[model samples]
Target chain A: MAVFTRGFGGHHPEADRPLPPGQHLTADFPVLSAGPTPNVDAARWELTVRTESGAEHRWDWAGLQAMPAEDVTVDIHCVTRWSKHDTRWRGVPVDAFFEDVETAADFVVAHSYGGYTTNVPLDDLLDGRAWVAYEYEGDPLEPVHGGPVRLLVPHLYFWKSAKWLRGLTLHEHDEPGFWEQNGYHLYGDPWSEQRYS
Target chain B: MNTWHVAQVVAVGRLTSTARTLTLAVPGFAGAVAGQHVDLRLTAPDGYQAVRSYSLARVGRDEVVELAVDRVDDGEVSTYLVDVAEVGDRMEVRGPLGGFFVWHPDDVGPVQLVAGGSGVVPLAAMVRARATSGSPAPFRLLCSVRSPADAFWADELSAPDGVATTWVYTREAPPGVTRPVGRLSAADVDAHVIPPGERARVFVCGPTGFVESAAALLLDAGHDPARIRTERFGGT
Candidate 1:
């Protein structure tokens, strides 16, 4: 993991002015965030899925990691307008996260906490541009920034990196997430300068 | 003080199909400084959450928190707020964030405000504060925009007789426009900003390149770096 240092500001503070307090934390792939850790017992954590065919299945820790995994490095652009260049991750391969495409009904609707949801085209998922990241910067994930496991879709904007991710459902089309449904662009491509319309 | 409240819109609205202003009105809110931000907390149903920071555009007498937002294509939360959040909507928010960049009326330094694009939000606030504070400090603004239509506060922030406003349009010079056409040169900043020196506090905001280049030009002209405050946002 990256070093989380104390301090802030690139210039001088006003007299009697308190120096801005902050941690210079960088995203170290395969590890987790240096911020506060979330409270969720790995043993009690359960992830379930409802297939596009309307079948429900549940799994626990061992069941998830029991699957195969892969590695990837990608850049992320936050809608707030900051771009985190090239982050690396290792996680369950999409091929393992799915069974038959026919079962998914053609799309993937990701379900996360805080009532946030986003949908991805099954083609996008199958195209091998998506995966579930378990290790960042080469270590176990952290909860504060969605550790243990997170849905990391690098090809899209950083917002697609759903933290504290829980489950995925196969859908037939695209659906918006907490930010997407708002006024954000449907396809976030940084090179396109697609800040908005 | 008020239980340190953070907000996230459970629902959102697309007030503008392109750019958006996320309005988080806090009651008796500990208003933000002229230039500061709040980190947005988004808790997904599946339990994944993210905290992204946004700058406060303006802080009026009202306790409302206005975040000037430009929609990022496919930005999960930003999009959610623009396309979804509503008047009754509630979202997690925190802070009167950021320190290096801020302005208040009581401060005695003569001020020069400069901005490009949406970065005008904070500078606009500072200008407003300076105007109302009764501080005899002579203030000037040199803002750059793409065109007349893209100018955020074209009418209000203009100089006398519409000869020129605090803002300059880089794209098209409207007929009868008085400000310089095209990007403002270092000479323009020097000419408009009175007695460019340490007694003047120059603030530059906008795209990272714009802010950096402008600040560099100011420093090159012998302005003390200490008296200059700036905020750099957005870019590749």
Candidate 2:
């Protein structure tokens, strides 16, 4: 048996700064998904916000690009330990998309290609907290990395940012997403370590 | 309640220059199945903590579990487990996690395992379980690595058994191998793996890119998407 004499691996100098509990600073982005990556054609890509009463608000690739887009830099945390700080994204804010719409639903279920689904509170998606981002670091998102478009909800765990996002289904009640249904917490807050139900 | 449990390192063995295998004596271990993984937590003296998940390379009778960790450059927890943590060190762990991506001895038909790099850990556990349980089910493993030196469990996997082992070297092959160094082509997969008509249950584990390619190849080869189970690690 090899005896380890060195102490716990040296800490990052940035360890003193506030970070989500159980997370470590990582310069590399780790890609994790439950299934195969869906290749969505940009021309056919569309994002729809369907209300409970059967109202559909749709945005095609051109329409979404024509909307007001904002560049955001924010810290993103994953349920997994890696945390990448100051990620730059360009997209249409959720508030701008919903500004003219009226919805009585309290929860939103994000639907993605390849049958992935996750639910978020209506409040979390509003107030400039979330975006339907199509670009990362100024390049069009790659397909394997959820290109064309993806939901970016910075306040919650990265899983909340559904990849290959196709539509948002507004619901009157809360429902767990793919991971949430599989033992993850309904509301994943990295700081609170709400990883599991 | 999936809370952290204390695990003491009982032994350590180097598998490769960048990888080490740790044997842990986890008190109250509930006997994890093959292909399941555990989350290990390391806390610094200054109160900072890091957590990472590693597949159980081997599961023993209560109180014992093994994990093979490959140190990723700039990886916080992998560096600790593979290089720093010594025998007798204690760490917090939560697991036997993941019900999917597991194989049971009693499962019907042949089992096909496709692994890339260090993703062989959990599949190795399944191989061990099949041998220990004395199941006669046919098993095949198609592993992709950079070289013979990078492959883990060479001795055990090479042992003659119902499990047919094949290696696809992306960079370098063993001394006398005639095959060129390259990725697993469609022809290689079709020739080495069990045909889809045999109704083999396929489990592929690796980084996202490897898994995506492998699963797509399997689908292209006519395997039912429902029968192919995949588990991806976070890497290029």
Per residue, candidate 1 scores C-alpha lDDT tens digits across B1-236 of 21335443322323333566667756556757777666665554444344456777675454567776766565555566555556655545556655546777678767777787777878877766665666666677888877766666556677463212365678887889876677867777676654654478777878665775676677667676667776665432
lDDT of 2 by residue, B136-173 (tens): 88899999999999999887887886489999999999
| Consecutive 10-residue window with the lowest summed lDDT within model 1 chain B | B8-17
Q: Estimate the lDDT of model 1.
A: 0.60
Q: Over the stretch A1-197, how does candidate 2's per-residue lDDT look in tens digits?
A: 22222367555546546888777777767787766666689999998888888888998999998999999998999887778888899999998778766889999999998778999998999999999999998999877668889999988999999999999988999988888887788999888988788
Clashing pairs in 2: none
Candidate with best TM-score? 2
Candidate 2 interface RMS: 4.4
How close to the true structure is residue B39 of candidate 2, measured as C-alpha lDDT? 85
**Candidate 2 regions with alpha-carbon error over 4 angstroms:** A1-6, A99-102, B104-106, B134-138, B196-201, B219-228, B234-236
